[model samples]
Target chain A: MTSQTMRRRFAATTNDLLDTDPRVALTLADIGVGSFNGRNHPDRIINVGIREQLLIGATAGLALAGLRPIAHTYAPFLIERPFEQIKLDLSHQDLGAVLVSIGGSFDAAAEGRTHQAPGDVALMATLPDWTIHVPGHPDEVEAMLRRAATSDDRVYMRLAADTNTSPHPATGELAKIRTGTARGATAVAVGPMLDRVLAATEHLDINVLYAATVRPFDAATLREIAQAPEVILVEPYLEGTSAAEVSHALEDRPHRLLSIGVPNTEHRRYGTRRHHAAAHGLDVGGLRTRIEEFLR
Target chain B: MALTTAPPAVHEYEELGRLMSLMTGDEKHSAAATSTLDVIWALYDQVLRIDPTRLDDPARDRFLLSKGHGPMAYYAVLAAKGFIDLDTLTSFATYESPLGHHPDSNLVPGVEIASGSLGHGLPIAVGLAIGLRARGNPARVYVLLGDGELDEGSNHEAIAVAGRRHLDNLTAIVLDNQSASRGWPGGIQGRFSVEGWAARRVNGRNHEALTQALTTPHDGRPLAVVASTEAGQ
Candidate 1:
């Protein structure tokens, strides 16, 4: 299957939805949807012209005025730059909006450090009552955006250039990809990390699980599937974003965990996504080497 | 629409102080609330077409208190206009009361947006104007800001966008108490004028001046009124 960018699917799905639903509105910070501007409902599709803070604030206001607003922009500009607006305007005011962001982790590695947002999920996790979705494929992006647009809850859908080989249709909970014997190690992969994770553990005896939605982390399912004392968590964004939840899920039993993802240190090196992935030990070979070392 | 309860029998504006006195318990922002007392009163009493009966009406005017740090004046005005019961005034800031230091849209009867942190209200107001316009509703959107709050860059973003979009249904009231660390060189009204908004300056404490300035017609652009008053009055 040919890989597709999640940003393209997001624009298509949102544009289609805007045609039928008058309640649905789109706010942009001059990031996505350059071509769809002419066909889109001029009033519904608001381009705030590079103002990230107003992007969120206006979305909150649209929600306040009884409209469902989907605010889109790059990850760093959407989450980090206008964080206070997200906290006070939307969350504090009890307003609902669908915040869809692109350029996850190091997808914008070529654009330099300013464009990358490895901490988007971790930062959004700080706010209460947010539904965070890290979709791994274009199909998943379409499904998640449709779901979030129909609901009144505050949602943050993180999309990226990195994608799994095929879409995993299962959502809301963890999907068990391979079940191993009890008392062995279990590997949990989040979003786009599934492809590399599957390759890394292809010949191993450990169980593997894939998750598209990370927030409201499925501890119940983890508790049921994680029979072994050793668990490996591989995320696409910041390392150990869900470590506390994993520990809490297994509080009754003493277990060990190995978290693999982008490290905390800034690489500061300009390169491709693959170069950054390899540098952070997130590639298939690096992941396999680390997982094998941990199992031994 | 008329007020839910009978209009207060006695001096209406004078009763604001009495309502404000009901919630006193070592509040730090009593002075801050006093600074916005007259403007809030004038807006609720004369200019705004909102009441408890029309709280959910799409065409009803929206009044957002952007300068939300001191909201005693806001609570008093809501009580005076009968959007909220006068009985709820004494419960302000209590653990169980809906009336907190900063206004919450969900908890309060007629608040359009929750605001306390500076510079959020104006942008939200701009968005509301756009949303209302898209819905083809003629309701006007109004937001009140503190002079010091302009130090936040978010307000500038809203000011520029609203002016550029020609949001004629929106009005921003800046209660300039001369409180910013570095005050605007040409005065706050000039800041709005430079951004293509219809700008005006008035004595914040004078009801007639506030009404006249706020009601001034700005046909094809957003309006900004810098109501000057003493800080901590």
Candidate 2:
């Protein structure tokens, strides 16, 4: 597995897009400036100097001018802080832009809560017509960014420090990876949680599916693949981020869903991402125990 | 609905009063609407290089109303310039009316951005200036803001960046009715001038002053015109 982080891959892909596509523009808020500076199209790359509102506002302006703008920053600043800008400027104006953010849930655990945004996906769910992509590997970053740049859609590409050892195709569909015996239980692993989920349910008879895109949730595929009434959703962000989508898809029949992800309570302890995951019962041992209990 | 004769350009001021009177509602925002009436009229009649026929023209001047409250003046100007029907003004803020208290760009022809939330337009205008300049389009971008709207920190972010970028094609018209809870210490012009914008102060009601200020050449820097009206009602 290549050691490249998703953030680096996103920056590299964005830089390449800027070099080739005239319609592709990037707006920054004093984050990752060094990686993108001195590119072929300096005018297309704008750094708003730590102003997240302007980051989204300027990106919307570019979109209004018929250009595909990509706005980048940390998760909190990119999604949480200037959310109104995202809602009003981009959504309300009926314009489109690619919002690529770094720092998944607790990726920056050592930096404390301010640097983390566990609620990013939940907040984005409130807005309509947004394509939310949470890629599990660095290899998936380029394709997602490219698709968003070439089209006029409101996309939120979340890049995290945690990555799966292997790269799955960047299809926004739910790809069924494992087959369970007699369809005992179906577990959906989102983004970076694929590796841990695979390990946890390895010895069990649970069907597993991988998702890179959460919004516009692939309801059709889930309904087809989910042969059993029991479903377990494991996400990298807030635990129940995709619970509503799952429930809505299976509402016609009697079904049970167990959501597993980061908890809502603040741990208040600064450590590594692994530590945070373990604390939230998202580690392999914790996940295996929880899934087995639900199955029994 | 029969076709009516177009009003003469000189009577547009009185035409605006009549146009504004057509719309009546609980949220007229009369003070805010009246303060900006003269400036809006002057821009559509004299300053803006726009045509109602070519709404999608890339070279057409873009006007974004940042202060979207009490948009009767804006709707009146848009109607006076042939962007919308005069009859539509009578249905402003109605359930079926395209005209809302705050203009929606999607619903309203010729409206650029949907704004009622303060401090959003200036930042968006900055992006427009940058995108337009990069694409080599010669169209100018104008944004109308209220003095109270400046209290939103987002405007300052736009002001600072527009100045640093030297966006000559961007102009900000601030209707100052002295309504901000905390006023600018040296005045609104200083806040913009300090950041390299060509700043000016004029009586918002003075047609000659507004026309000159709006059309002034700013060379390599952006322009800011502080048009003072009477104290807010």
Measured by TM-score, the strongest candidate is 2
Q: What is the per-residue lDDT of model 2 for residues B1-233, given as tens digits with 9 covering 90 to 100?
A: 11112233433667788888998993549988998898888788778777787889898889899999999989988888788999899998889999998899999998999999999999999999999988999889999999999999999999999999999999999999999998889999999999999999999998888888887678999999999999993
lDDT of 1: 0.88
Error of 2 at A50 (Å): 0.9
Model 1 chain A lowest lDDT segment of ten: A31-40
lDDT of 2 at A188: 95
Best by lDDT: 2
Interface root-mean-square deviation, candidate 1: 1.0
Residue-level lDDT tens digits of model 2 in A1-296: 23389988888888888988999999999988988844577679999999999999999999878889999989999999999999999998889999999986999999999999999999999999999999998889888988888899999999999889988898899988888865668899999999999999999888899999999899998888787899999999898999999999999988999999888887798999999999999999999999999989
Q: Write the per-residue lDDT of candidate 1 for residues A17-120, one digit (tens) a residue.
A: 89878999999988775845535598888888889999999998888778899999899999999999999999988889999998878998999899999999
- Looking at model 1, give its docking quality level: medium
Task: Give the CAPRI class of candidate 2.
Answer: high
Clashing residue pairs, candidate 2? none
